[model samples]
Target: MDKIKGIAHKYGNNINTDIITPGKYMELSIEEMAKHAMEGVDPEFYSKVKEGDILVAENNFGSGSSRETAPQALKQAGIAIIIAKSYARIFYRNAINIGLAALELKEAEEILDRDELEVDMQAGTIFNLTQGKTYRFTPLPDRLLTMLEAGGLVAQLEQS
Candidate 1:
């Protein structure tokens, strides 16, 4: 898990939680809701996405309610990581708590859809294989990295 390699699914700004998971589907199980993830913005999203794909986007990538399920849906839908210019504090925390790798790359808009990317979390770098370029992101804190490695906060607590 040192590096994450995947095809990118790029998005635009203001990608809210409601747009990501749709509030109506909130009562459903995480798995069931996952099948409808991002449906509000892209009706074919669930079908279009493949396991281990990376989600890239511009500013404010997770902006609505503090629903942890929003991030859970994406994770369940097989999004391996998220690269965005910025993120809502709540959504970012939720992603980390659930062991979903959500990184911030100021140059996220430079990445294209379906671009093959290799990410080094510890090194804070993204290599865009398709575009033949590299981007750097802010490194994660040591404690947060530890939580992610143990599979989110709950799992980390269990291990402790």
Candidate 2:
């Protein structure tokens, strides 16, 4: 499993698809779309995030729409992972399908903003060493883990 390290952007519940990757910028190119990713919620998002950074949000993430572009935009923007309290079913599936690591944690709100996190996908653990904390999550199934490790469904299929 890949190890993800980054500063967190913590937000509360109901962070929907539109806030993640807005519809108005969907028609743009990957580089262009990345510039607008998360612009709805955080205007400085694109400028603030570095490659391999992670986004941490509360429950109902990726709600409001089933658009695949939501995850695509984040991936393009160089987000390595997203750990949330809960995710919309379609968005969760889409995120996994596209190689973006996402985990559901029960105590998501407990994590502070800008808290540096180290996520171990294989171990199903998030190490918040900044504050001497560790959060555990339900591990993804072996098959799903395989897909995520191989860079999502299409890459997994291609490998087969």
Candidate 3:
């Protein structure tokens, strides 16, 4: 399993895929779309995120459209993991298909923006590895954790 660490970007309810990667930018290259990624929600999103950063948000993450490009943009923008209260069905699958980690947690909003978090994919736990220590998330399922360990669903299926 991979251990990922990053600064959190806390968002509230109903964060759709469109906000994740706007439809207008769909025709653009992945690299281009990544530059404008999440621009709708946070104007400084792309600039704020660095390589290996994580996105920690609230309920209904990946709602709306079923474009795989949404997760692709995040991956291209260097997001290794996304922790949220829940995920839309298609977004969750697409994320895993592309080797991005999508973890479900009940208290994701408790994590503040820029909060340093360490995500242990194998252990399925998120720890506020920062000094403030404000938030922590419950472990993911063992089955899902195993898939993450294998580097997402495709790889997991290949292995099997």
Best by TM-score: 1
- Candidate 2's C-alpha lDDT? 0.87
How should the candidates be ordered by TM-score, best one leading? Answer: 1, 2, 3
Across 28-96, the per-residue lDDT of candidate 3 in tens digits comes to 999999998888889888888889888888888999999999998998998889988888899999988
Given candidate 2, what's the lDDT at residue 142?
90
RMSD of each: 0.8, 1.1, 2.3
Question: Which digits, one per residue and each the tens of the lDDT, describe model 2 over residues 1-160?
Answer: 7677888878788889888778887788867988888887788988888788788888899998898888888888778888899999999999999988889999888889888999888888899967889999988899998998899999999999
lDDT of 3 at 5: 82
Tell me each candidate's TM-score: 0.97, 0.95, 0.86
Among all candidates shown, the one with the greatest lDDT: 1
Q: What TM-score number comes out for model 3?
A: 0.86
Computed on alpha carbons, the lDDT of every model, listed in order, comes to 0.92, 0.87, 0.83
- Which pairs clash inside model 1? none
Cα lDDT for residue 18, candidate 3: 89
The sequence of per-residue lDDT tens digits that candidate 1 reaches over residues 61-158 is: 89989999988999898898999999999999999999998999988989988999999999999999999999988889889989998989999999
Q: Global CA lDDT of candidate 3, please?
A: 0.83
